[model samples]
Target: MDTTGWLATQRDDGETVGYLEPLSGDYSLVQARNLLGHPVGGPTEFLEAEELLIDRGISELAERWSLRDAPEELDGGVVILEASPDGIVVAHADLAKAGVYGRRVHVPWPDVDLLLSRETPAARET
Candidate 1:
């Protein structure tokens, strides 16, 4: 029997790639690549990396934003703390009331660029 609850797909650079396939338990790292749209590595390598991300509670959808860890919402605005070859780390809180926790999630460079393009006031530097 198929225990499919949800399916999540996304276009990273441009190609439509599979992100989450609950029925097959696949978090596809093969879908995440440089702008050129080439597979990052062999299928086995991609699978291993995908597994590690999921084990850390970073769902396939979350991985697009490079969320390698479980999210913890905080009380503040979105701030880009760091950027590296791997990804950009963003500290952001939900738009809830004050006195709440913020979330620190790692987003890949591509996604980071996309977010920065939005240019929200809260994300502005002080």
Candidate 2:
């Protein structure tokens, strides 16, 4: 997302947890995705939006996600390696094999179809 004018919200430790986007009369809470941005809540009071991000934003990143309408090799399962304003770098779940062969791709953030995975990394560990 374009956050050229958004106000950044930071944790006590000075880590930016999210951003407060200025709207007409309210602010939108956009969670920080490894320096990238993702809207999670919006159009609320500025303080509320900031509080929401501080409380929930960081934990959200731990959740696993999958891609839709992407190449078959990047579809089944993947993990976000890094995210920037330009795009996100994702690697296939079969990292032990595929990643070894440099199976990573950069896709536009807005164009990516990010879906919450039914199975999380923790679930896969078990």
In candidate 1, how many clashes are counted? 6
The C-alpha TM-scores of every prediction are 0.27, 0.67
lDDT of 2 by residue, 24-118 (tens): 43344333332346565546766777777778646644445566555777665666676555676767766624445247777675432443333
Can you tell me which runs of candidate 2 are displaced by over 4 Å? 25-36, 96-101, 110-126
Worst lDDT run of 10 residues, candidate 1, spans: 58-67
Specify the highest-lDDT model's number: 2
Candidate 1: which pairs clash? Answer: 65-107, 66-106, 73-101, 73-102, 74-101, 74-102
- The C-alpha lDDT values of all candidates are 0.37, 0.59
lDDT of 2 at 92: 73
Q: TM-score of model 2 relative to the true fold? A: 0.67
The number of clashing residue pairs in model 2 is: 0
